[model samples]
Target: MMLLIKNAEVYAPEYVGRKDVLVCGEKIECIADEIDRLPVACHILNGKGLKLVPGLIDQHVHVTGGGGEGGFHTRTPELQLSELISSGITTVVGLLGTDGTTRSVENLYAKTAALNEEGVTAYMLTGAYGYPSPTITGAADKDVIFIESVLGMKLAISDHRSPHVTIEELIQIASKIRVAGMLSRKPGILVLHMGDARSGLTPVIEAIERSSVPIRTFRPTHVNRNADLLEAGYEFVGKGGYIDFTCGMEGQPSPGECIVEARRRGLAKELMTVSSDGHGSWSNYAQDGTLLEIGVSKVDSMLQELQKMVKELSVPLEEALLYFTSNVAEAMDIGNRKGHIREGADADMILLDADLNLDTVIAKGQVMMEDKRIKKFGTYEHSK
Candidate 1:
């Protein structure tokens, strides 16, 4: 159906004036001062007094399901389509974490394909929480180079549970990623799963200096989980590297505070991103290495973080929106299609009421939620 959204106080993450957006099928056909005239038989949405931002792109999500660190019983179930849609997330890049054995790359790949079939955009990373990452082709480079959905490999760095890879090992992995990305024209980012190990990002910086891998290739996440990690993240951002702060992991410093502090410290704004880490376990480690406690992931944390940035931190709406949308899109090299509201772009958008409540969620021109109610859900979500 052709749809026209009229008089939206649009913030394509920027204050574009009062404009109308016309969507044809799954793509935006026009975004201008006025659509001139609406097509016959088209649905019209009066967006008066509403803010329109690009639908969020969460780069580091366990969409297939994460958490098996505590045990099989503690394993979090896979995320449902509505959980993401209701949270204003339109595109997601799924990754495997500590449960690579039970949750294979094949399953992650299949889940991504399934989400696409269900009308939500999804992509994935290869490898998991181990050295010598498991891949469908038995090689990380081959997977990223050949598979369209495979963007790069993930490394568990500076965490006690990690493989404790040396700079040489990290460099070698990044080398393969570089070559593969060069051949495939993909951004072969090394998505690092960081923890509160306290070793800091020194090793990562050294690895970049010693190898051909650019600083932008090393994407470290979980920066807001701790004070020192946050400081290290700012340093990385200053050095032209990107940092990802995960929402829903509590008991550390305030994530909102860290983001505000980063801005105050004059860090590059475009290099920052926020992800949900949804469905992943947040296991706390005691001083002696015992698992103290854990928590289930929440899909709403992405918006929670965004709200914190805008409300508590007094961050402008435009800059706040970029953390969850455009920054991630640029980091993953999906800038053309995802993470922005533009003509000829995917019609993925979120309409927020004046109170910042998610009122409408549109993924690929299909309304998944309206008036705080979900209109669509995943295949197994409602199964008895």
Candidate 2:
């Protein structure tokens, strides 16, 4: 398939105003000010002064749909393809959060592969909320090194709900992932899941300073969950680490505030990224060892955060879009085919109107949505 999007305000991070993008067979063939003429059988999309961005990549999501806190029946179902496409997410890094017992690594792997097979880009982390993580290969290093769909290891760190490994144990886990990632040529990262834990990232900070491991190996998420956590994240960034702020559920500290606060405190912009923990469970666990309440993550929060940055805070649209798109691609080490809009890259891009509302979404050269209506609905939804 050939697609020509014209008269679009383009930002592949840096601005190329009123440009054109040409996609043919899942690769961007050309990007420029205009392609004056078209070949036979060309599909032309009138950008209509809309903004074209690199497709959003949610690096941390429960693609298999995590839950199970309440009971066996409460385990969230696996995520559908349209749920991601409708939200303008082209690539997702699936993880098992808080329910690795019921949700195995096998299911996470299969779900990721299913999404990829169905024509969306997907990858997963090996570990979950446990100390000794469940892996398909029984070893974290082997999973990252041998498994193509497995990119890194994720653990719930600093949370009371977490297994709470010591600094030495954390370093040991980090070392294995780092070595395996080096051998496998993948990210081999430790994607830490931060909660409302009061102890903060002190353990992570101490380990990085004391160990031989590089700071880049640790990628912390949910920094915006609390003020102190956000502060810890900023300090981590200052020491040349990457931080991920979740586009968490509404009524939390807004993602916009975290971004602005980080900048206000003089943190490097590239050290930050944003993700939607879509379909993952969010719970307030009581001290008495019970889930007090629970909520499911909405896929739309990724787009909502982007809109808030551009419209509410007056942040430059290009700068804000990077967190959800390019920055994430870079963080996961998949920039070549996933993040940017360029030649030889996957055709994962979103078309938005002047107000930053998602108008069209294309994944892997397939138009999954147009004008905010999903061209591809779930299997059961379409059956009806």
Candidate 3:
């Protein structure tokens, strides 16, 4: 398939001005100010008033569903293809959360493959919030080295629900992943689910300081859950570590607010990324740790927060886009193909109206959504 988008304002996550973008099959073919000659059977999209940017890459999502804090019945549902397409997410990384037993790494891997078969690009992390990390091949390092879709591992810290992993234990885990990542040429990162505990990022700080493991090996998320954690995230960034801010968490500053605040504090902008813990459970707990209520987070919050950043907070469109696009791809080591709109990159792009509303979504040169309507649906979704 060939797609030509003409006369659109392009951001490439850095303002490229008005240009025409060409896509051949699954990769971008060319980008120019004008191309008068058209390919045979090519589809031309009039992008006169639209803004074209790389499709968003969500680095932290519970693609197979998360939660189970309340009980088995409270587990959230798996992500649907339409949900991702409508939100302009062409690439995503799936991972498990609290329930590693009930939710096997095998299921997570299958769902990751399913998302790829359905349309959008998908990758996954092995393990959950537990210490002895769960894996499809009986080892976390093997999962990264052998499994094609497994990118890294997920673990929790500074939370009551966490297994209270010690610094030595954390370093060991990072070491294994680091070596395995080197072997597989993947990030092999340990994505830490930051909690609101008083310890904040102390353990992660000590782990990096005391070990030979690089600071980039640890990707702490939910840094915006509270002021203290966010401050700690700034410190982590100062130490050459990357931090992720979660969108759609109640009582937390929106990812947009967090990014603006990070900039205000003069933190490293390239080291910060944002994600929507999509399809993951969001629960309220009593002071005594009783589960008060539970609800699922929306995937669209990623796009919504970006819109708010540009339209409401006065952030430049290119600057607001970095957290969702290039920054995330770079953090996960998929920058060469996934995040940019340059020629030879994957043709995963989204077109936005003047208001920054999602208008069209193209993944790997295939139109998934256009004019704010879904053109492609998951295999089972069409029946519904």
Candidate 4:
């Protein structure tokens, strides 16, 4: 598979000037100012007026279904590949959320495999919201080491859905995940789901205070759910931890506010990331625990936030993109292959128009989307 992309205003997430990229098979073979000649079989893309960048990677996505909270009718449908391709996402991390009983780790793993086999790169965490979280091999630690795609585990902290773990339990679980990561030579960090509670980060703080585990082991997501949670979450980020914000919700802080606030506080830019939480259920409840409303998150929201950060917020292109591409790839410990555009890196890229709309998407040297038309879909995709 030889592909030649010509006259691309390239930003390998760092503003590399106009260059031509050559993709050989699944890897980038060469990148230069000009490629005078290529084999007749090579596919060429005229990238004039288009900026080519590393493909966007969504770190938190529910590829399989995620809800069951309200009852049997509320379980979300599995994510579709059309949603990802049109949004410029070539790599995604899938996880199980809320319904560990009805939805098993097997289903999540199967979906992950299906997505990867279809087109994009898909990875997943092992456990879910409960204590002694569900695992394929019956042990979370062993699953992380033996499973090729199981990189870490996810747990809900300070949420009504969580197991309400003690400090000791937190320490034990974190320790196990960290050890599994070490054994597997992968990033075994815990992905924490934060809720709308008064004790925002109390459990995380207590765990850090009581144990010697590295602070980076915890990744508290949905920090931007509320102003108070963002405020408290920033403290953890200050101390060498990471936080993820969910995008596309109304009544929450805009992209400008969050990025500007992070700059003002001088937080670690690399530790910050944003996710769509796509295909998961977003619920609103009354004080009495009755479900009032339910809405599903969209994958397009991640692309929307990326556009907002660059165009509306006046953030530098490179700086604004780190939260979606390279920064996220590094956090997941797959930076070597997934993130940047380099000689030996994976051939996953996206071309954008002046307005930042996705013009084309290529994953693993295969063209999946072009000119706003989707060219690829999963195995069981419906034509209608």
Candidate 5:
């Protein structure tokens, strides 16, 4: 149904003043100081004191369940649609991590489809945690170029659990993703999982030095796992590469602190993004590399971090929202369509109360949540 929202203090992720927004079908029709009566049936919402901002885009998630690190019994459960919508995430990028053996890229693909059908935009990477990673079409490049939902390849580097593949192997995969992205007009990013090894980002530097693949082709995650790595991430961004900081980290500075430090260091915030690693397993390891504790991640961490940036660190809401919205959308090659609030953009927005809590979530013109309740759920979330 078309929607007409009146008196919203809009933040297109850039502060557009209080105005009326008209939605036609699944896209935003127009935004103006005043929108006259529509010619068709429409759902009207009064937004007199609400903040209407573009719905969040969470770049990293383990939608099909990401953990098996401690054994089969320790693997996490599949993500529920309510978890995402209630937490204000309107889009997600799902991928497998260490347990790619039992969990295939096929599982990630199926879960992506399920989330899209449940009223959110979902996409996924096609590989995970190993050299010669698994792909839907038997090759990362083929899957990226041929499959609609497959965006790029994922692999674990600089981690003990990783395959420890040679630099040559890394080059081969990166080359395929770069070429496939060029052919398909997609971002074809190489989403590297950063582990807590002492080498930090040396592997990424070696890969860039050994070959000519553009630095933008690489998207390293978990860059804030440690102070040294976070500093390396700043350097990476300075060199024109993109990196993502994981939220919900334990015993470390909050994502707000990291962003503040980045600003103080004069790092390019435009190339940085934040991800929740929702539904993945986060392990607490002893120096001997023994797992001391295992816990699951939550999607709410992403939203909480955004609020902290604005409320605690005094970051402007527009700049704070960009890291989670436009920055991520641009990295996926879908920036114009997914992240901002503009004419012809997807009508994915959230309504926030005066205190900045989520009051409503609308994805592609459909209400997924309102008044702090889940209005939609995944296929199984509502059923047995």
Candidate 6:
């Protein structure tokens, strides 16, 4: 299949001005200023008055559903393909969250595979929020080295629900992942679930400081959950570590605000990224460690926040896009093909109208959504 998008203001995540892009099969074939010649059976899209950008890459989604804080009944439902396409997500990383017991890593892998087979690109992490990390292959390191879709491992720290893994245990996990990542040529990262506990990023900081493991081995998320954590996140970034901010968290500073503040503090923009935590549970806990309330996160929060960043917060479109596009791809070590809109990259992109509303979504050279309507649906989505 061939897709040609013409006369669109492109932000290959870096403002490339008006240009035409040709997508052949699942890769971008060419990006040029003018191409009058056409290929037989080629599909041409009129991109006038539209903004073309790389499709959003969400690295922290609960694809098989997250949450169980309240009870099993409160656990969120698994993600649907239409939800991701409508939100302009072309590549997503699935993972388990609090309930690693009931939600096995095997389920996460299956959902990741299903998403890929359904059209969009998907990957998953092994383990969850507990110690002795859960794995489909009996070990986290083995999962990374053997499982093709397994990118890294997930663990929580400083939160009440966490297993309170000691610093030694944390180092061991990082070391194992680091070695396996080298062997598998994967990122082999530890996606730390930053909690609201006062300890904040202490374990992560000490783990890096006391070991030979590189700073990038640890990817701490939800840094904006509290003022203290965000401050600690700054220090982590200063030490050459990347930090991810979660969007749509109530009572937390918006990701746009967090990025602006990080800029003001002279932090490197490349060290920062944002994720929706889609389908994950958001809960409020009392001082006594009781869950007060809980709700599922929406997959569209990243899009909403991007609009707010560019329109409300006055962030430049190119600058604001990094949080969802290039930055995430770089963090996950998939920048070579996942992010950017240049030739030789994956043909994953979204088109936005003048008002910054999503109009089209193309994933792996397939038109998943067009004119703000989903054209592709999961196998069971529309079935009676």
Which structure among the candidates has the greatest lDDT? 6
Cα lDDT of model 6 by residue, 171-288, tens digit: 9999999899999999999999999999999988888888898999999999999999999998999889999999987988999999999899999999999999999999998899
Give per-residue CA lDDT, model 1, range 276-317, as digits (tens): 888888787779988888777877898878887888788888
Model 4 Cα shift for residue 78 (angstroms)? 0.2
Report the lDDT tens digits of candidate 5 across residue range 235-311.
99899999899998887777778888889989888888999999999998898988898989999998899888888
lDDT of 3 by residue, 215-304 (tens): 999999999988999888988998889999899878878888887888888889999999999988988778899889999988899999
Q: Would you estimate the TM-scores of all the predictions?
A: 0.97, 0.96, 0.98, 0.98, 0.98, 0.99
Best by TM-score: 6
Per model, state how many residue pairs clash. Answer: 0, 0, 0, 0, 0, 0
* lDDT tens readout by residue for model 2, 1-384: 999998888878667788889999899999988786775677888996788888889898898878788887777777888888878898988999888887889999998888887778999999899989989998989999989999999899888769999999999999999999999989889999987778888989889878999999999888888888878888889999999888874566777778888888888888799888888878876677677887788888989899999888888988998788888888878888888887889999999988788899989998888878888765555673
- Identify the superior model by lDDT, candidate 5 or candidate 6: 6
Q: Where does model 6 exceed 4 Å of error? A: none
> Candidate 6, residue 223: CA error in Å?
0.7
| After superposition, candidate 2 runs with Cα above 4 Å error | 249-251, 287-290, 378-381
Once superposed on the true structure, which residue ranges of model 1 sit more than 4 Å away at CA?
none
| Higher-ranked by TM-score: 2 or 4 | 4
Weakest ten-residue segment in model 3 by summed lDDT = 35-44
TM-score of 3: 0.98
Decide which is better by TM-score, 1 or 5: 5
| Model with the higher lDDT, candidate 2 or 5 | 5
